[model samples]
Target: MDIDVFATAHRLEWQRLDALIRRRRRLTGPEVDELVELYQRAATHLSTVRSSGQDPALTARLSGLVARGRSAVTGAHASAWGDVSGFFVRTFPAVLYRMRWWWIGSALLSLALGAGIAVWIMADPQVQAAIGPPEEIRAYVEHDFANYYVEHPGASFAAQVWTNNAWVSALALVLGVFGCLPTVYVLAQNAANLGVAGGLMFAHGKGDIFLGLIIPHGLLELTAVFVAAGVGIKLGWTLIAPGPRPRLQALAEEARAAMAVVLGLVVVLFVSGLIEGFVTGWVHITWLRIAIGVAAEALFLAYVFVLGRKAVHEGETGDIAHRPETAPVAG
Candidate 1:
């Protein structure tokens, strides 16, 4: 019965229902109605899973979720600290894993566009002149770009850059609702800007300097951005094609996840900002700086592919997974 497809189609409803059942002392009238509807849908899903698949795990998980819903849904609630930890360890990574394809595609497409733009600028004098006058371009390539990192105190700069990047990431996610056009526009502008800078640097024989300064922080920073763009695109697409679910419900579900997704992105960008401010400019050894950047990028990839994959395998989807009740199940 294509269990994965079924789960993906309905997981959001389950998550919403689980949340309504577990938390919130008060539910609005609509939310209460949603809870009841979700409960019924989950029961149908459980029945489907049991009848069509030999997946004991799916059955047990759904059974637990249904049981809780049946019981006006209770909990032996995890501590606030544990909940926070779980959000990072489980929920956040699951979202990353789930959205991996979208972001990866975004990253590849943006990179290709940036590279193409850089090549065009380098190959054509008209393009180069259109970017800027020679003197201004040379100044940017030789001095301004490098000086940007060191112009401000590291701590303050890091904070400022973090806030800015976080806002950009959040904006990318939020703007997804209007349509992918806005999100695509944002990504295109960023790629074009980067391409212009890179083309100018390479043309002026400062390519090494550019990479050295940018890679350490740029790797992780751009990744965070790509993640946002991807999620945003998906959110926008949700409005257009909600698959089996109703359109508004699909949008609401995605929007809720998008909001939570921003919190994790803030932390990701803060790390990138620290590296940009402290390591990119201050670290004297070029190899060491580049190595640090590589390490950060590697670490982030591992975090998503490893922890994120694990979380998804266990049905985590950046929301409270519909878990089984605390009581022992009868054989």
Candidate 2:
């Protein structure tokens, strides 16, 4: 396995195969046969060069040649639409369903914290004063709270909400590997903010208005955030308890599923943003707005429970099993 000798011996065959691949469309029957032969031989060469720890440059060259040869042999893969279809039908929903308890628990816990904070703030004048000046609080409860939603144009507001929520969710996922503390901090901060706002509104006797405005969009929006935090926390937990699988394998599986959740939440959050921007401020009908929110939340839950369950039953783990780029060094 002399590195220089191997490279010199197979260099011509590699070049010939490259040329044939570039012009594969116009190759005669014999040339196509020769191309296939050369490709097979080069694949073996690649394996040998790699195993022997020979010249890295020669290995890279062979790797590229084999990849191109695979494309030529296998033709193109399935269309983009196929991938998208599989994602929604299997990957996204399966992930949501599989991790339902984690996210649901997260939502319940966060809601409790937020509600506790609100009650504490309402019960204690000192808490209210600690938050801000009385005049500012009065202004917020009387005017600012309701006006915040309507201050911007609906479309612009929706876009802003989408961007902000997506960033928060993405950040949670990205930082998940650091352990669960950061994820818990994110969840706590979100809950505390909600608590403060609700406490202020309730204390001022604008509780009904708060419910009318926040419930319409908050149901779905908060659920999406909870899913992100739950999945993130689960990622951190995977480090502590990888279960039966090896730690790296367990982490990889969770990571793949987390990615699917991230993509799925983008769509979920977008819908919630639309409700917040368009329906919450401008609709002005209490029952109707709340009904719309309930409907959206129900649909999302159904999607996860029904479709996701089915996909999981069919053995979809939300990870793409086949990856072409993962050749020998792939996966």
Candidate 3:
């Protein structure tokens, strides 16, 4: 097929379609009918160009023109509420379920590392000495640790925790494009901190206090972090080995998926922050607080497994509606 001849033959029709799409709002009933017919014709033209293996540039421009035409004819500007509803019901859960193993592994590894570090700290006298004098350690275990939460007003404290956790999750996600190194470092640091805190509390015979406070919020809070980190690592791996797809294409898809996880985790972290600020410190009953955390965690897991699995089976990829995304090139 002669590229010049093909483009010249269809150029007028394409230009007419473009003009009608631009002025679609003011089109009369008959003109609207014309627009729909032109849109369908342009779509067929695009399919022909794609199948012919003509210039990639020609295919891309026709693709865009057809997309715009379709939008204008079909009223593609959907309501915002509909988009939000679709995200939770399909996008969020599908992404969560699709990547479940990645996050679950992260959660197990981090928790194991944290618990191991705590045990090591407790058993090693030298490690205890290295941390601080016994008296300072005891003071932290009994007073300063718990006091940290109550020092600020609940509302302010919740905001502070939410912002901090959100930032951490964002970093893990954004930096993950480079490779998994940054995310791994972030997760390791977090796990180590948890271990140190728990180990110190147990060493001073305040394990009950530590568990009571941490369990109420830490369950959900830490899970969100692990999820973020896991997704980030997965994004980095996509760059390293994109499998059968082109590397850039693979990275773009994974990056989009990771972003959805990032947005969803913000709400999850906020809930955990609320529990930390209000329930962890304020609630007197230990078992009740832990139960609340457990319940929150349970709901999250259910959302992923139930909604996510169903969405995945229904072909959700946690991405926007599929269309040709190739950028237009000058003809």
**Candidate that scores best on TM-score:** 3
TM-score of each: 0.76, 0.81, 0.93
Q: Which regions in candidate 1 have their CA more than 4 angstroms from the true location?
A: 1-75, 320-331
Candidate 1 per-residue C-alpha lDDT over 1-331 given as tens digits, one digit per residue, 9 for 90 to 100: 7888988898888888889987545888887777778888898988998887556677888898887877663445678899889888988888989989989999999999999998888888899998788899878987899999999999999999998888888777778778788988888888998898888888778889989898989999999999999999999999988999878767777776776678889889989999998999999899999999999999999999999999899877775355442223333
Candidate 3, which ten residues in sequence have the lowest lDDT sum?
Answer: 322-331
Q: Write the per-residue lDDT of candidate 2 for residues 85-163, one digit (tens) a residue.
A: 8898889999888888888888899999999999999999999999999999999999999998999999999999999
Give the TM-score comparing model 3 with the true structure, all chains together.
0.93
lDDT of 3 by residue, 231-267 (tens): 9888898999999988888888888887789888989
> Over the full model, what C-alpha lDDT does candidate 3 score relative to the true structure?
0.88
Instruction: Write the number of the candidate with greater lDDT, choosing between 1 and 2.
Output: 2
- In TM-score terms, candidate 2 sits at 0.81
Clashing pairs in 2: 326-330
What TM-score does model 1 achieve against the real structure? 0.76
Show the lowest summed lDDT stretch of 10 residues, model 2.
Answer: 322-331
**Pairs clashing in candidate 1?**
none
Model 3, runs deviating above 4 Å: 325-331
